[model samples]
Target: MRLFPHPFAALVVLVTLGAAAQTPSSPVGSVSPTTGLVLRDDVVRALIHESSGDRIHDGVQRLALLARDNAGGYTEAAVWTKAAAEAAGLKDVRLEPMKQGPQWRATRGELWVAGPQRYRVTSHADLPMSLAIKSGSFEGADLELVDVGTGTQDAEYAGKDLKGKVVLTRGHPSATLRRAVTKLGAVGVVSSYSTPPWNLPHRLDGDFPDQVGWAIVPPGLVPEGQPAPFLFMVSDRQGRELRAQLLTGPVKVDVHVATEEYPGHYGILSGVIPGTRAGEEVVLTAHLDHYKPGADDNASGSATLLELVRTYTTLIRQGVLPPPVRTLRVLWLPEFEGTREWFALHGADPVRRVAHFNFDMLGASLSRAHSRFLVSYTPDWNGSFVNAVSESTVAFMNRFNGVAYPPRKDFRIGSVTGSRDPLDAHLDRYSRGSDHQLFNDHGIPGVAFSTWPDDTYHTSGDRPELVDPTQLHRAAFAGLSSITVAAWAEGPGALDLARLVAVHGARRVAEDEFRARRDLASAPATGVAGMHRLARAVVRAAYQRERDALLSCVQLGAPAKAVRTMTQSLERAEAQALERLDADSKARGVSLKEPAPSEAERRARAFVPRRVKGQELASFDELVTRAAPEDQPRVATVQAALREATTALRERGEGELRFYQLPDALASYADGKRSVADIRDAAYAEYGHVFPVEALMDLFGLLERGGIMTTAR
Candidate 1:
């Protein structure tokens, strides 16, 4: 989808006009606490404008604006929070600063790439200043700027001694260049532009891995500053002219840089629209600040929260939602740190009843152009709640003006056993590039609204200019409706019932499938009777675990017996599988069973799994061999898809997918299948990771686009 910025002129005006004149409304069911009323529009506009206006727009701008004392200990973030609170008319806003670790400088200039194939450098500052040399030391090197025109790696730098020297040439680098660089023991490598103007300056910026000589030039030997190393470019006419001058002497250049650090804060800007119920609270959250302007990244989310607060406050004034069953709290946090602090201070128990509606980047439809929808990462246990909430929100959005509301393609449900799914963008290292990770981690029933990741990300260009006010309104309305309906629906009673039923059903399915498959596979005349029995045992064990997870998700009312039975079933299956495998190994006279548990399984059980990547998993053949060696070919196809699934996995790094499915992919693949490909494909197709091969390829391309993978071939 071609992502473009949505103009916010209308919403901006509405918000500005409302905040400046009207008095803010009191909490729901409360008397006239204050003798005034603030138009919801104005408050919304003011909050957005206050957070993202001018150079101080949406960033943790240093306290220079609010207070001039640079060394006064008040950080830009502190001042900004204070200002935001005052603008929202929040009471008792505090500017507390948390001491982050001291900053560490890049001790040496570096050329950092995804891996070691020194392809195109995409970062702005790091590339240009870095010299292209592989890891290891450069004792001494020298080479000339004679462009060998367009030719092979050997022909290009051949006849010329590049040993202990730098070589510069143009045209796409080949495996030969890789070998040449290795063979000649070249001290430096530089990619030069024969063209006149550099269109993308950011493309040329990167670090010189180990403080190597960093220079970019046309193919020419410029004048010398010393007995300089190699400097060259393409054999274009311009390069030839420069080399003629360079034979006289090689030019030398030196670059240096210093870095600075900012102390961070573990704080969030939060206010409560308290519910009439004493214990219940509903959370409407969006991250307040970011490292960049983060328009679609999260400014859109902050805006959504402000709009919802305004809408909810208005509802209270109109007595439409009097004395809500759960209090509504809006929080603008500093990602995980703020959330951790908040949870630590307030406790997560109250948040249990608290259904969360998180507004994240809802402006840019990254891949789903003019398309948006609610995503439910709930387990099968609370499938009902997931369904109701997702469906109701979409319905609400549709009612909010068909034009403003984009049609949702479908409800997306995912599971990674217990980690994030790779297909989800919000499950990244940053966890949806917002603060939703906290609530999801703590088992709170919540959903996040975010636009797809665009090109902006953490760059300076992620500004309000890209925001779509209408998109913002529609998403916020959907979020508000979901929360309101959930708040009014008593509690998790219905969901609990559904969970119980699903768990029971899943267990039945698992047992029936296990017995049927095992009996059939173990029939007397099977060709590979031993293998069949083992496969049956393995399949039964896998289903038992899957059913156990389903039970965990199932909301049972005092189904302790059912839960216990599920657990025992899984344990029994695991023990039997291990025993059978061990016996089979002993029968074959091979000590396949290490006596001790395999480290991978042990770690999978105890340690949380990290996200899977190309380097993280075994090779395709190895993976397939592990899954089902007897079905190697089919498995190889699947493994190829999985290895190429790097891009898909990365995309799913947003939101809750990173927390569950993405991490779980490793475990799913670790299932005792002899074929990694079969295991991956089966898990993906049967579970939720399935995608078209082309889609997988596209995703892989995105992840490895300009980056290189340095795996042992």
Candidate 2:
């Protein structure tokens, strides 16, 4: 699990150099038709050679030293990042302040076992993660500890007093705090939550015993009238020890936590590498905020951004690389909250942002962290050719790095320094967890580069020593190459991108067809109509995606004639695919139309739902409770039924519900311009079937009650 490869491994790699160069097709230079940028052999060679893992490692180590739990930490990180950007010869480097409420910082924290022999447990002075984030100041002596397993549900608290006690649970700190402290009147909480073992890589052997990085909720973000409580995160080892002691007899702990909260601003550092075009840019982004010593969770990502900027700026300055035709802007943010604020403020600009390459948890060593480098795309629903470009770039790098061949036959064209291990990287489907989600939600094309199933994620065990420099280098190369190609892509490059999109779309359509066919085969007779409807809808969606990809080429300044020809060809291909699917449905005797709705259902469809802008769901819930007292019981009943149905489906081993589940797609269709019937048709077009007319009406009625929507008569 050490960060560095063994000396014997290094020796073996060195001895196999001759055999690594035998791949004759692995040429040094080639033109990328998609970007219209020639892959200069000397420049490519220099990029790989000059990208320094040491720089990335050192940057991570430096950032890891700052206490990043509050506004002060945010400020310090921004300062350091700005300095690094300036050093890299980047322009327009500055910190943009986001309007946020007071920040929380722990001044002091300590815990001690008082019963069965007094002994020290943990202290914030020694290790910051011992104190949960956002935990308020508290002092307690000889407080009894009560076990409330996974203390989120009401059943977990049954038969337990919990009052004035420190409740223990194997749940996320935030969830445990809400139940054990806010509801059950517990003075504090101790949680031993770890990432699920099943989700981890096989090589890790499920050995994640690290303290959680719990944070107290910020002032404005916290729910109205709820008191934030003190909480502590314990490693699994400590929790097990405490549990064993409790088995012997009653146990007590002495705890003291001194924390401060004050008004502060979220800091975002940004710089630009101006290109020939004034308005177009490709964004390179990573979040800079995390707990102290949060190396892999975010320091790795932030450091990788720094290293990439350094590499690009250095190359551009030395005249080894041409400046991109479009600007490359680098941004360091404060994760989701900060990203949301930034978008709200600055995202309405007329300037064209081509794409975003986001880095998060990008420096974990494959050997140490049991991680694979993942190039995660935006969801298929948020269709774009960005994923294809990223995949192609990573494929090239992997081949060059010998990831696809034996060590003896591996090409080390980009092996500047570190282990000769092939880039253990692959492309992953869209997943929502990081800042990239913000961009995707706003219709921006974004991709996330991350190391998945990080064992030390959000834990004290996430420290600088756990980061892998070689991994950082590979990530930088992947991100840099991708953005470089995107920023400079012109007519020929745009055509190349269009081709990739066409190929990718065809494959996606085939995959969807297969899934739909399998679903249809297993469906009940009553569900056959819905299955066919879904098939038609999926085909239409695929065609729309292909259309959007072709349109992007036009946006990228491709020749109109070429783009037009490509679009026409793609449209024809899509038509044929759709026709084939329709024929298959007919042969299977599947009906593709639904029965007409009743008069009552027609009335419901006439109702138009206009969403209440800027209202949070919780606020909307309260609004509904106040505005439609008569309908409250019905809404509650529906909510309970939905939850039960979801639980049953999950229990039956169905995967997580798709986006069209319940009211999600329905809500999106709730523009005032769309009637209830229109919305139903739209839903049918996208999902292949609509919710029952009554179900849709009930949802809209609830939305109306909550002021989330105003229905037209």
Candidate number achieving the greatest TM-score relative to the actual structure = 2
Candidate 1: clashing residue pairs, number: 79
Regions of candidate 2 where Cα sits further than 4 Å from its true position: 1-46, 152-162, 172-179, 196-207, 210-228, 401-421, 521-526, 590-593, 597-713
Give candidate 2's whole-model lDDT.
0.70
Model 2: colliding residue pairs: 34-493, 35-493, 133-214, 133-215, 133-216, 134-216
Q: Per-residue CA lDDT of candidate 2, range 263-333, in tens? A: 87878788998887888888888999888888887988898888888888787766566677789888898
The stretch of ten residues in a row with the least summed lDDT in candidate 1 is: 30-39
Candidate 1, residues 647-685, lDDT tens digits: the string is 565454422233233322333233222232233333442
TM-score of each: 0.45, 0.81
Model 2 alpha-carbon miss at residue 217, Å: 6.0
